[model samples]
Target: MPPGVPAPPRPPTLPATPVAADTRDTVAAIYRAHARELWRVLGRLGVPPAAVEDALHDLFIVVQRKLPGFEHRAALRTWLYAIAVRIARRYRERLRRDAHDPEQDVVSPARPPDRALLDAEAVRVLDELLSRLPEAKREVFVLHEVEELSAPQIATILGINLNTVYSRLREARKAFVREHSRHRFLGGDAP
Candidate 1:
């Protein structure tokens, strides 16, 4: 009926609270609010605990520089996760290049002995199981289970099909169970 008339502008679907015209302030606010999430995602991506903070710092550095171009086509968390995955890969490569061994480093001396032991065992078991999962599965599991992101959010973050995200999560759970059982059989820490 109105083919000859001009079309109206489509409203933006992305939420605008965290994203605004001032790039630096928007990015700084995001860092304040979501840096811990970035750290957790980086940890799941295989960034060593000692290096996770550094990786996070590095990630924000990228975000700070690129914030101006961020189109908000995706949720802020999804954008951060995508950046984290890339930074984790780079950090892992850098760790390999440097021949660093996180295990050989000294554990913190401040914690009580029993709690430290428990934490160490927990980390050992989790690392063992998560490392054995495929990279895709691990990311999906961590994003869905640990981070509590919805399937659609995880799909957006990973840029994968929605169905593929669900499959990976299912497979990751199975793989984790298998690995945990194996660890238990070996008397590592699993119950």
Candidate 2:
């Protein structure tokens, strides 16, 4: 070793601080700001609407536990979205093993024709197309087109290459277009 001017002083270690309260506040703030988007992502990722609220709660618990170790290598929201995706995927797997479909429980009698129902119907149709897609293609399409994330950010989130993201997105777009054209109601005005 070269003669070093006396080694650099070690970083000062601060005594343990009350981080839990601060963490709670931070978590609360994150929930307040990003909960809706997280819910949307979870829904699109296939967490049944009925289970999304509970899934969101579970997601926050993981966030609280993992927040301290977050290194800021990615955008906070992106990291949260990644966590939400993982939670949703696991939830779907569990539900499959139990052979339960949450959508089967959603029954509404006494029809009220409203704008909300129309919108919901459209979303259902869209979900059917999305559900038909391979997970990789669906994720890339949603992250890019729906969530408006850049290609690079998506590559980071999915741990895939930039080229793969573009390729999947291309495939997803073509499939979505084909499906959309097949359903006249999807045109949004005339069936």
Best by TM-score, which number? 2
TM-score of each: 0.74, 0.77
Q: What is the Å distance of residue 182 in model 2 from its true position?
A: 2.9
Whole-model Cα lDDT of every candidate shown, in order: 0.73, 0.73
For 34-125, candidate 2 gives per-residue lDDT tens digits of: 99888778777777666777889899888776665555454998788778878988888878887987556557663422224236866667
Candidate 1 vs. true structure, TM-score: 0.74
Clashes of each: 0, 0
| CA displacement after TM-score superposition, residue 172 of candidate 1 (Å) | 0.9
